[model samples]
Target: MNKYLMTIKNKQYIRFFLIPTILCLILAISVVFVLLNQRKGELVDLENRSQLQTSLLSEKIAGKLNSLELVLSMINQSARSMDLDNETDRERLISLVKSQLYLQDDLEGLCILSPDGSKIYSSFHIITENLLENQQRMITTHTRQDISFSLFSFIDNKAWHLVLSRSLFDQSGDLVAIVGLLIETHSFFDLLSVTEIPGLERAILFDTAGKTIATWNQKDALGKETIHLEENIHLIPSFSDSNILNTQDQTINAGIKTVRFENSLLTTVKLGNFPLSLGMETFIDKAMASYDNALVISMSVLFLFIIISLTVITLLGKQVIEQEQVQQVMMDELSEKVKSRTAELEKLSTLDSLTGLINRRKINSLLAEQIDNRSKEPTFCCIMIIDIDHFKLVNDNFGHQTGDEVLIHIVRVLQQSLGPLGTLSRWGGDELLVLLPSHSAQQALDIAKDLLVHIRDNPFSPDIMSTISIGIAQYREGELSSDLISRADTALYEAKGSGRNRVILG
Candidate 1:
C-alpha cells in the first residue's frame, strides 16, 4: 500500500519525534513528583507552625481574661468590705464605682442595681425603663452567689453588650445590691484581634455550638444572631491535650486525623474556661503561589522548546525538496508572536479590567514616585481613601455582575468629578484612592464634599442608592507613603463610625 511506503520513508523522522516526546513525558512526571514531595514537606512545617501559633493565641487570650477576672474579684472584695447601710459608705461606694469602674477602658459603663431591681446608679445616662426591665429580668435569671458574666444581650435593641455582675451581701448574708459592668461585644473582638497570624487565610472564633462568633476576615458576621452550625461541624475539633487537629483527607470522617480542608490546613485551639474555639486556616495554594508561578513559566518554556524541536524535525524531513531559508522564516515568525503575547500579559498587570482604572500595583508605584518627589514640591499633596458604603450589600443582593456595573458607574462619576487635577485608582475591594498634587487640605476637603453630594444625588441603581465615605490625609514632608495611607485609613474608619457618607480629614 502507498501508506505503508510513506511510513517506511518517514521512519527516521518518526523515531526522532517519539524519543523526545517520551523523554518530555518522563521529565514532566519527575517534576510533578518532586513538586508534590516539596509541597508535602511545606504543609507539614506549616501545620506545626500554625499549631504553635494557635497555642500562643490561646495563652494570650487566657492571660488577658484571667487578668480581667482578677480585677473583677478585687473590685468585688472592695465593694463587699464597705457597709452599704450607712449613707457615708454609700457615697464612698458611688465614688469608687465612678472613679474605678467607669474609668476602666474595658468597661463601656457601670450600673448598680438595688435588690428590688431598681437602678441605683449608672455611669452612662440614667437607665431607660426598658433597659431597667431587661436588667431586672437578667438579675432574676442569673442569681449566682458569685461573680458571673451574662450572655450577650442587646441594650435597648441597639448594640450587643455583656454584663459582668457581682452580688453584694451584708454581715447577715442578706443581698443588698448587684453591681454590673457593661462590656460592649467590641471588647472581645479587640481581644481576639491579637490572634491574627501572618499568612493565615482565615481566623474565626466559634462558640461550642459551632456558631460563628467573630472573624478576622468577615467582620459583618459578628452579632449575627441567626447564624448556626452546618453539617461541616465535623471540622470542629474535640478538645484534647494535642491542642491541634489537621487532616489532608478527601472526605470528612471521624477517624481522620489530618486538619486539611480543601487546599487549606485547619488549626484550632480551645479558649481556656470559655465555650469558644479559635480556628485558623492557612491555604496551601497561597503558600505555594510563587513556586507554582515559576513552575508554570518553566513548563511554558519547555513546551515552546518541544514545539520548536518538532518544527525543526518536520522542516528537515522536507529538506529533500524545500529550502532552508523557508524554515528560518517560520522560526522568526513564531518567535515574534511569542514575544508579542508576553508583552500583552505584561501590560495587563498594571490595569484593573473591571473598572478600567490603574490597578493597585500601578497606584502604588505612582504613590511612591509622589512620595519621593514630595519634598521638592511646595504645594500640599493629599491621598483620599474613598469607600463605597455598604458596597458588600449590593454584591450580596444584586449579584456580582450588578456590583461590577456599580463599580464602573462609580469610576465614571469619580473621573468626571476629579478631572485632570487628581489621579484616581482602585485601592481595594470597593475602595478607591485619589491623589491630588498642588492642592491644599482645605481644597481637597471641598472636592471630597462635592463628590459625596454628587454620589448621593446620582443613584447607582433603582433599588440600591450608594454613598461614599472619604478620608483625606495630606502628605507630610518627611513621612512615608505607608504612614500617610494609614492615617487616611484610620480617618476612613472614623468617617464610617461617625456616620457613612461623610468626609474626615486626617
Candidate 2:
C-alpha cells in the first residue's frame, strides 16, 4: 500500500510540473515567431514610407527646376532678339530683368554674361568672381544646346545661391552669350520645411561630387539660420559615391535606396535629371521605438508565465514590486537633481558672471527676435553700443581689479539712468550693448545723452575717473539684426574718433 502511494505521488508531481513546462516552451516559441513577423512588417512599413516621401520630395524639386528652366528659356529668347552693345538695348534688358525679379520672389537676381564670362548686364551691383568663373566653366564644358546648373554666391555673405544657365547662339550656331538666373536657396529650405514628416531628423541636398548644397534639421529649422554649405560639406554620407550617382542606366539613377550610416538609417533619392540628390535620415532608435517597446512587453509576459509555472509566483511578485518601487524612488531623486543642475547651468549660460547682466549670445538672440517682430509688424526700435573710453589705459595705469570695478560702476549708472527703457548686455570687455524697443532715433539719442552724463558723474574710485561714449542706431524696415548692430558699432567708432565722452546717432 505504501509503494502504491509513492507511485501515485510521483505521477501527480510530473502532471503538475512537466505539463506546464511543455506548454510554456510552446507559448514562448509562438510569441517569438509572431514578434519576428511583426518586426518584419514594421521595417517594411518604414521603408515604404521613406520611399514615398523621397519620391514626393524629388518631384517637388524637379517641378521647381522645370519652372526655373522655362523662365530661363523665356529670358534667353528675349536676349537673342536684342543687341547687348547698344545702350538702349542694354537698358531694355535691365528693365526686363528687374520686372522679372519683382514678379518672382524666388529669383534673387539676373545677369547676362558674355561668352568669355564677363558680365554685360546685371540686376544687382554686387557680383562675386565665383559666379563669373562658374558661368565661364559652363560655357566651356557644355554645347549651345545644353542648359547647365551651378552654385554661386554674392561677395558680401556666405549664403549659397543656385544658378541655372542657358547659352545663346547667333544664326551661325556659335555661343554668343549666356543667360543666368540666380535662385534663392531659402525657397528650397522652405520646401523642405513644409514637406517634413515625423521621425525625419535631417534632410540634406548635395551635388554629384558629394558637396552639400543645403541642409535642414527638424529641430533647428525654425530658430537657427540656414546652414552655410561650406561649413557642412563633410556631413554628406561617405557611401554616396560616384558608382551610385554615375550609373549608366537612367532608371537606376532615379530609383531610391536605403543604407545604414552610423546610428542612422539613410534614404537617398536622386533629383530628376539634376546633378543633385536629397538624403533623409532618422536615428535607428527613433525609427524602431515602437517595435522595441512591443518586444519588451511580449518578453516580460513570457517571463511572468514562466515564473508562475514554477509555483513561486506570490513571493517573486512581491519582491519584484518592492524592487520596482525602490527603482522609482531612485529615479525621482535623480530627476530632481538633474532639473536643479540644468536650471543652474541655463542661468549661468545667459548671464555675465561679473556684472550679472545679459551676455553677448543672449543679447543677440533678443535682438534677432525684435528684428523678426519688426518685419512682421513695423515698430520703432533702437540699439546703442556703449564703450568705456580709454579703458585699456585704466588697466595699464591702475590695475585690472580697478578696471573691473570701473566696468561694474558704469553698468550701475547706465542701469539707473536707463530705468527700464532698454535691456543692457555686456557685449565684451568694457563694452555694453543696450536694446531699446518702442523707441525712436530721437528717444534713443536722448537716452544715450542721459547715460553719458550719468557715467561722467559716477567715478569708479575717488582717484579714478571713467567716461563712456554712446553710439545709437534705429532699426530700418526689412533690416537684419547684424546690419543694425553693425551700424551701431560704426557709430560708436565715429564717436570715439571724433572725441571721447560723446553721443552719435547712426
Candidate 3:
C-alpha cells in the first residue's frame, strides 16, 4: 500500500508541475516570436519613412542647385554682353556680380576668373589664393557644358565653401572666363534642419571622395558650433565600400538604400547627377523603444500566467486566452491612435500655428506645382509679398500679446479681402506671400492696392493702426520659383525704401 501511494504522488507531480513548466516555456517562445515579428514590422516602417525623408531632401538640394545654376547662367550672359577688356565695362560687370550676391542670399560671393585662372573681379575686397587655385583646377578639368561643382576651403581652412563654376565662351567658341559662385557649407545645414527626422543621430553631405562637406550632429544644440572634419578623414566610415561609393554605378546611385550598422541604421542617397551624397543616421535603440516596452509587458504577463498555472491550471488556461484577446484589442487601439496622430501631425506641419494660414513650406510646394503645370501649359501667375510696416514697434510699444492680436487681425482682414482670388500664406515674421494664379502683373498690382486700403481702413486697435507694403512680380516663361520670389522680394525692398504703405512692381 506504501509503494502504491508513492507512485501516485510521482504521477501527480509529473502532471501538475512538469507539464505546466514545459507549457510555460512554449508560451514564452511564442510570445518572443510575436514580438520579433512586430519588431521587424517596425523596422520596415522606419525604412519607408526614411526613404521618403531622403527623397524630399534630395529634391530640396536639387532645387537649390537649379537656382544656383540659373544665377550662374544669368551672370554668364550679362558678362558676355560687356567687354571685359574695357575698364568701364569691367566695372559694370563687377557691379552686376555684386548685385547677384545681394539678390540671392545663399551666394557667399561671386567672382569672375580670367582665362589664365586669375581673379579679374570679385565681390569681396580680398580674394584668397586657395579659392583662386580651386577655381583654376575646376576650370582646367571641367569638360562639361553645364555648371560644375567643387568643394574648396578658404581662410586657412577655417571656412569651407562649395564652388559652382561655369565656363564662358566668346562668339568664336573660345573659352573667355569662368564665373564662380561660392556658397558656405552652413547653408546646407538648413536643409537638414528643415527635413529633420525624430531619431536622426547625424546628417552629413559628403563628396564623392567621402569627405564631409556639411554635417549636423544631434549632440550640437541650437547655434552651437558645426563639426568640420579633416580633409583626409572620412566622416562616415560605413560607406567605405568601393562599390557603395562608386558614383559611376547608376544602379547603386539610383535611389536611397538602407545600411544597417551594429548600433544604428543608415539611409544614404546620391544627389541627382551631382558628385555628392547625403547620409542620415538614426539610433536603433531609440527607434525600437516601443518594441522594447511591448516585450517587457509580454514577459511580465507570461510570468504571471506561469505562477497562476501552478496554483490553478484550469483557471490559468482561461486567463491566458482572455489576456491574449485583451492584448490584441490594446494593440489594435494603439495602431489606430498612432495613425490618427500621424495624420494630425502632417496637417499641422503645413499650416501656421498662429494665424492658421498656410506656412512658407506649404506655399513653396504650391508655387512649385504651379510652375510645373505652367511648363506643361503656359499661363499667367503673379506672387505678391506683403510686409507689416513698423511691426516691431507694435511689439515694443505694446506687449507680445497685443502683437499677436495685430497679426491675427491682419490675417483676418487679408482673408476677407482675398476670398476666392488666390492662396495667402504666412511667409515669415511680419511678412506674408500671396499666390495669384492666372493673374497678370497689372491685376496683381490692383489687388495689392486694394489690400493696402483694406489694412489701412481696418485697425487692430483704435490706438494701433497697421499699414502694409506690397511687392508684386509676374512670373516669366522658363523662370525659377526662387527667381520669381527674389524679384518680388526686391520690389518689396524698393517699396519699403521709397516709403512704407505703397506698392512696387518687380
- Leading candidate by lDDT: 3
lDDT of 3 by residue, 1-506 (tens): 34544554466556656788888889878888887888888888887777788778877876787788788778777766767778998788778778888988888778788777667877755557877576666666444323333334333256557777777665565566777888886676687767766566677777555566666664543343323323422434433433122223422245777766665676778776665677776776766776778788888888888777767964554465456556656776898899899988988999999999999999999999999999898989999999999999999999899998999999999999999999999999999999999999999999999999999999988899999999999999988999999999999999999988999999
Q: Per-residue CA lDDT of candidate 1, range 67-91, in tens?
A: 5555555656676777877788788
Better of 2 and 3 by lDDT: 3
lDDT value for model 3: 0.76
TM-score of 3: 0.53
lDDT, candidate 2, 227-337, per-residue tens: 333443344343333312222221225678776555555677877766677777656566788778879998998878787766664455445555655666677679989
How many steric clashes between backbone atoms does each model show? 5, 0, 0
Comparison by TM-score, 2 against 3, better one: 3
Candidate ordering by lDDT (highest first)? 3, 2, 1
Give candidate 2 misplaced runs (Cα > 4 Å): 1-13, 124-159, 218-252, 260-263, 312-506
Record all residue pairs in model 3 with backbone atoms less than 3 Å apart, i.e. clashing: none
Q: Rank candidates by TM-score, best first.
A: 3, 2, 1
Q: Clashes in model 1: which pairs?
A: 246-258, 246-259, 247-258, 247-259, 247-260
Off by over 4 Å in 3: 125-133, 139-159, 218-252, 311-506
**How many clashing residue pairs are found in candidate 3?**
0
